[model samples]
Target: MSQEITAAQRQHPTRVASKPSSYRPEVQGLRALAVLMVVTYHIWFGRVSGGVDIFLLISAFLLTLSFIRKVEAGRPLALGRYWMHLFKRLLPAVVVVLLAVLAATALFVPRSRWSDILAQTWSSLLYFQNWVLAANSVDYYATDQSVASPLQHFWSLSVQGQVFILWPLLFALAAVIARATRVRFRRIVLLVFGVVFVLSLTFSIHETYTNQAHAYFDTRTRLWEFAFGTLLALAIPYLKLPRPLRIAAGWVGLAAMLSGGFILDVQGQFPGYVALWPLVAAALVIVAGQTGSPIGADRVLTWKPLIRLGDMSYALYLWHWPILVIYLIWRGREEVGLVGGSAIIALSLVLAYLTTKFVERPLRSMAWVDAKKRRSGVVIAVCVALVAVPVAGWQQGLQVQKERAEAEAVQNNPGARVLLDGYEDQSSPESPTLPLLSSLGSEWGTLDGDCSSYDDGPTDPVLAERCVGTDSQDYEKTLLVLGDSHSQQWLGAIQPMAESNEYRVFALMLGACPFGEPNSERRPECNDFNEAALRYAHELKPDAVVAVGTAAHPTEAQDNVVAGLPEAAVDLAGFGIPVVAIRDNPRFGVNMIQCAEANGDRGDDCAFPLSDKLSDSSEMAAIFDSLQGLALVDMTDLICPDGWCSPVVGNVFVYLDDNHLTKSFTASMSGEFDRRFHDAVHW
Candidate 1:
């Protein structure tokens, strides 16, 4: 929104106006340098852009200095005036970018991805993009750059806006307190700065240890960096430095700031001591500027090219990230190597410069820049509303379309449909035997797990107590399939086989349950769900108990279920009752649905091989070997052969997530699974 400004002689009751021409070209050069570091780091280095830290210091110095000078001059501080200036400076170009991005996304990205883009666009417009991205917890160091969101660049702006909203109030309050109590303004301000600094520092460390992702985005954790700048601001004017000392500080600061760009890497735990280096460097440069030293800001930062970049820095920062992200996504790699990444950076810079020249500068110099007669707020509101309304509608429409498409595709491709919904009913005793005629529409009715409500037992369409027809059978041979979704996913295949083989399969699975002891409050759910599963297995007196999951170990039980199971199920020598483990299929981390849509394949042709899906790591191999008193079935060969696994094999979709095979794929592999089970367990 734009703020109303007038040529009237009015000023705020608590502020004084500084000279209007206090524009510092050197600061612009600093901004240019900061943006360059951020863009380069994000695209090629996978590290914090020391540039952002530098920018934060600049912001703190400029804004704090402005506020303090006005307050000290016996003039009123108009919060409205400050907001107006900020709004005019920030809004027009941001709104333009949002509109352009919204248009580009609609035209280029798949319908399935539109929802994410829309949400991000809205957040970007609101300057809340950082929080939105933080909530998603995207890993910056991850090699998969294709999944990077377009609006991820807005996090810095979000942090800045958040700090801006608070810094002024703190300054005003500290000033008022000093005046009221006859305390020196500097002392009062410094005390407030110290308190904020301490609180922010303490919280940042705690958050970094507890949740680094949260620490990165949370305003509380970041407030200290800005406060550090604020502290430097209060001390600057009081210092009257000698010429040589000022020159040395300037050059040293410049070297420290520039050198920091090369020294810092992504591995550094950020916002800790590492950030202070750049912040201090920026502050030193600013302080040196006032003295006009030969080795200071004027000699280096005011160079033509640096000034040019600095003039466009704000626009560049906004534009560069999205360009790089979209380019990386287009390339469809987890990590773009440095060469390609550098090319992306070059392109982003070109666009940034063009955007700054055409969009930001013109708007700032317009005759209406400070006009109060016309309602600029109304114009901004309209502009924002136009961008927001379409994006929201597009997002909602895309969601509906995706759901419809997913439903249709699932219906048409019975395998994916079955896996999506069949787990619920198939695991129950009454409905354990899925009708052979049932297709993808055969709904599972909802399953429960200790960690998830999936196994809480059917309350809806309330599954009959004996769905598996277990009461009619002589419950002599019992098999338990317990673990996470990886284990539960097998119900469609295993249940059918168990029913035909005259064996009952008892399940004690939990979603995301690693079979470990209680960790969170959710532990109760795990305990209760496992207890129910174990009770049923024990009562059935099965000949064999199968613990099936991609990642379940014998000692990792929630309450030592392995020791509690009837001794008949456990034989020191391969256990009397053999456990059967089904190796999970490959999982695609990228949203295959969106990829399919983008490729215009109608969601059928886009799939990768199992071997190509994930790295061959010890963690995966270990998950396959953790079952005790059981025979593990290595199905990696069933789905993958010659070191390749296709998403669609024999007209079957192999997986829904990173692991669970689609029911269609499961059905296709049923014959293979049956053979593996028979060979391993002698069933």
Candidate 2:
């Protein structure tokens, strides 16, 4: 029987091959180093350390090796069982951190932030936080503030979790293909992943160049990083190097990895070709393996302390971000100093150790839980429910409050009406603002109508999609609204007036791109959008064209009309389309709503002098007089009454963030806006 077994093993060398040990102490140490770099850079430097990329590569490398080994051994893939088991181990710490974040948000985060936090909590729990962030990054109205979400760091883990589910299937498919074609499984995997690497890397480079913010979290753009790891795993076993070269490579890789964050702009130019810097460094370290020399990087990486920390690296990564964010909020600091950062790191380490010891390890080692796939699935469901139930309840409660607030606003919030001549302030002082602090997230202006009736829209897809008709199809005349987000917000004012006056209002607008002649300083896309909007306007001549003619500054003494506004107005006048230029509203350096909430909404300390927000004299006067078809309407007196602009005007929140007008406030300005429109256009 022994002789027969030996002969069978000889016939299938892979089945009984003496493979290199799957455990690598140096890799564990590398994990420890990578996570430390991430925490340190985030807390002190406010930069990305490129450590998450290393984690991604290592995860795929280990996963590919394990799956390939199982395939070679002729074992069942059991992908479903693997997924259940893997998430069962991963989710306990994640749940603990999420629940902690929920509690911290309630205690430290402001009411204005609760809605966003609630949404992110669900996204993080479901492992789709990366997609949520990518969508937000590209949202035209998304705030450009520097406030960081406590759950933002989960983007990488979300990406990793998604890949974990898909990568095993890839290996399984390769195994099937190999059997069908009578080829080696490793060669098939190499070919399949090679194509994935090439295609995904090319897409990543192009997308990163085109839209870096969205590309940063896009899974398609990140697949090549995982593919590169799988390819490295397939090639590592066959690679042979001299001892001295191995030693040199190990040291060089370690040095490069340590210096990568300082030398490269990882946050702005990552997941692209530039990402190869840290990836190649990590690959070199993996290639070095166990170079049996004292001076080799493996010697330092094999230290017992680092290996121990690596055991808790996942928990550490999860705990540190929330702690850092909460600390920043609690202290009102943008970045932490050495002492504060040290305390944050220390607290994170303690929490991570506790979580790993009491939560992760015990559940991972539970005998009954490991015995059945059903048991693991039950644990995952339970973990999800633990976070989801309370989050849903909180959201439902907030919805009730928002509805109540909206009803109250309809009854008592007069908004800009109070600034009108002979108006009375009848609202109770106890009544909350039009958009309650809890409901501030929904303050952005939106059209109550669509663009379907307009048959001759702009040919530019972006402009055509944005062209909205906010009135009944049976209209006497058409009014074209054009410019940037400032113009979009004014739709709140235009909609009511159009409905009453029997005018069809079509809004053609883009965020951050005011309608004008293209300039070298502006983004090429925005410039192109401007030119397209102009051409479209000339062709489809409306009765009148409304746009923001001026740009406001936060601190400058004089606000000026945007460059080329006069020229664009003159050009449009030639097409018989009268131009109504609405002077832009005041912009503040700080969040005016947040300030109001913080100061009891009395609008005392939050008020700004009109002198600082607007020019001493009208900058549009000269152009308004010179151009025959151009009419200037300045509502600065209404928005900033008594030469002072307040956060809350007649029980209504005026601005959503620092600049854009709240829809409620603009809606209340309908009467004043109509009077001004008629005075200017005589329509």
Candidate 3:
């Protein structure tokens, strides 16, 4: 939310016939408090503080108040002028912070994160970052060692920006309906927003229950939060309360809002019915507006210092997250301690004050820029270009470098051939690594096409939709690849084998779901997918079923076979199909490609001891001894040769992120994989 409602009011005053316009300092103080909650909870508690919800509510409240007054006074909405003016005020500080983040990312963050940062930069600049993040389906609650994206907090702002455009259209539609039907304007406005609040809240509850990670950033799921604010605005003018009840509500609401982060599991359960706790608390405080009692929450909220801080609340919110994230990355800490956190907050406050003074206030108040609608639009365009032009250029540069490196890899990179006994090193040591760091983000292996294109694909909808298949129309053998992304990554090697052996490959893989019997570890959807895949495999009766049989750990000493692999294998055996289970690859705690980019490619600093990542022998061998038609294939020697796994193997980057093997690296293992597969299946 923009946090410049007072400035907006001053710039465009609406003629109110019934209720005279009045400035609410308590609301500004509330914004200040919400921003502090978000910063402190993020830096120290590592939890959601419900502050963003308050911001969304307050934004809609002020917006509705402005538009409804204009509609009542028979004044033009001037929506085009409003959008340009609003975004002109919002975009300047956003552009500054995004540019700062780009520079910080280059200086402190690893190379692996640059592509994502660049993508998010464009998304943030264009106000669609939330959808981009939802499409990625990242778990916002994850507190792993993986560095947080500096621009991730922009999701809330993106949602607000989207609502700002849509909410005004909603008001315009209500005005049209009132004029056409001769209904009271206030009644039509309430009916429209009330319907939105109900429908959006219902969808929000359902979506959050089903897929919370995606729902957390979904604009549809958050629209109700904004609608609630609009509904409250419509009701507030007629809301009459006794002095005692208003005074009590003021204190009660403030207490509830303060206690929400501590008492609720906000990270795990939010943006659902549970979110009503904070929204209702905020509504109560707003309803308790200007209780004259000295002990009332309004008296505390209207403090002069809080009012001043609220003026810079948007800047503070923008500056705090990147500072906290970069600080944690630089210090190599999970959570900032009290002293460091204090320093971070202090630095953020200073920057926020300076940015508000120098950038936000000046642009909002610039008479020359604000004189004409086109001038405001020009300011918006310039702000977007300042960040987008450089980001796009950097992206193009990386792509060019990656293309050049790929061209040189054909003759220079030997990959797994170098691991074979009696193989001589034919290439010079100066050869560049295959799948260079610039191209590492696109290294995940994928099939030639989905199964829908094949005439002989599975009849089951789940299998047909989820499966990826080879292009071979006629083949001697059919091979089914099943399990999680680990199994899918092996397609780089498997596809080459299929071409040589004339085997048609169809892979049905789900992220994080190993091919196994239903278990507690798998989500309900994953378990259902695994069951569907098994039934499809039985019906197809492929010559052999391929799956990753073991689980690798980043820090564990001994790797083990997946919990239900043997059971799944036995079920497949019942259908007279052979199972060729590949051993899992080594997983590292750090990004290997990033390490290689930081240090020299040949340096030992990027190597991890094999003993830490995997066991010396395959655990699946003994576990599947009694199971008929089951054979184990272990390639740990090639992956982590000489008892130490290095990031680069024979001038090729091995792992894409921490665990997933790069397609180029896997393709290099085709020779060894071909030999092992024939020996396992004997087909």
TM-score of each: 0.68, 0.96, 0.93
Show the colliding residue pairs in model 2.
none
Q: For model 3, how does the per-residue alpha-carbon lDDT over 1-683 read when each residue is reduced to its tens digit? A: 11222333444455243465647889899999999999999999999999889999999998998997777655688899899999999999999899999899888886667788898899998899999888776532122226778898999999999999999999888877876776666788899999999999999899889888888899999989999999999889778999899999988888898889999988677788788888988999999999889988999899999999999999999999999998877766778889999999999999999999999999999999878999998999999899988999999998887887777775688787789989877766776788866555567777796677766677777667678899888799999999888898899999999998888999987788888878888889788988988888888888999999889888897677787888888898888888888989989888777677778778998998898888767454676565666788888888888988998788888888778888898999998999998988876
- The residue ranges of model 1 lying beyond 4 angstroms of the native Cα positions read 1-21, 107-112, 138-146, 290-297, 332-350, 365-374, 406-411, 416-513, 516-548, 551-582, 587-645, 648-683
Best first by lDDT, ranked? 2, 3, 1
Task: Tell me the number of clashing residue pairs for each predicted model.
Answer: 34, 0, 0
Q: Which ten residues in a row have the lowest lDDT in candidate 1?
A: 1-10
- How would you encode candidate 1's per-residue C-alpha lDDT over 1-683 as one tens digit per residue? 00111111132432234333447777777788788778777777766757876777778877887876666554567776666656666877787777767776666554435556776787788888778766666432121224677777788788898788888888778767776676656688899989999898888778776677756777777788898888887776567788777778777887888788677652245566556778888877777764565546557788889988887788778777776666655665656777887777777677777777786677566657457623446556766787878877766665565455444442344432233223332222222111111122222211221212224222322121312322214434555565555665566666656656766554554554433223343446555555454444444445655454343221221111222222323432233345565544555555443443345332335544444544353454464355455465666655554455444432334544334544545554555567777887775
| lDDT on C-alpha atoms for all candidate structures | 0.59, 0.86, 0.85
Worst 10 residues of 2 by lDDT: 1-10
1 against 2, candidate with superior TM-score: 2
Q: Residue-wise lDDT of candidate 2 within 1-683, one digit each (tens)?
A: 22323443466787558666789998998899999999999989988999999999999999988987676655678999899989999999999999999999999987888888888998898889999899888778875446889998889999999999889988878877776776667788999999999999999999999999999999889999999899999989777889899899888989999899999999899899988988889888989989989899999999999999999999999999999998887777788889999999999999999999999999989989989999999999999999999999999998897787777765578888987789877877777777866676666666667776557656568687777777476888788888889988888888898898898887887778887778887889888888888888888888998898789898886677777777888888898888898988999998888778778677489998888877864455775667666788888887888998898888888888888888889889998899998999886
Better of 1 and 3 by TM-score: 3
Candidate 2: what lDDT?
0.86
Instruction: Please tell me which model should have the higher lDDT, number 1 or number 2.
Output: 2
**Model 2 error, position 462 (Å):** 3.4
| Worst 10-residue lDDT window, candidate 3 | 1-10
